[model samples]
Target: MATAGLITWPVTLTIGAGHLLAHNKHMRLLRSFGEALEEA
Candidate 1:
């Protein structure tokens, strides 16, 4: 139904944003670790 789709669209976007934030955090950690390794 149209109503259902409207409800789900925001939920889907919220979930996508969460995933992107998590991925960015993970990548940042990995990058910092790589820098440490390079320094050592």
Candidate 2:
């Protein structure tokens, strides 16, 4: 009972959203940094 309640839906959604947002922001920053390096 407790395992099923605590283990599934909410936790999966929370982790997925956090990872999605973080990876997107990281990619944007990496792209800008690459452009700057190329210009230099």
At residue 6, candidate 2 shows an lDDT of 62
Q: Which stretches of candidate 2 lie over 4 Å from their true place?
A: 1-6
Summarize candidate 1's per-residue lDDT along 1-40 as a digit string, tens digits: 3356755767788888999999999999999999999999
lDDT of 2 by residue, 1-40 (tens): 3356866877788888999999999999999999999999
Error of 1 at 17 (Å): 0.2
lDDT of 1: 0.87
Q: For each candidate, what is the lDDT? A: 0.87, 0.88
Winning model by lDDT: 2
Model 1: worst 10 consecutive residues (lDDT sum): 1-10
Give TM-scores for every candidate, taking all chains together and pairing residue i with residue i: 0.82, 0.72
Candidate 1 C-alpha error for residue 38, in Å: 0.2
Regions more than 4 Å wrong, model 1: 1-7
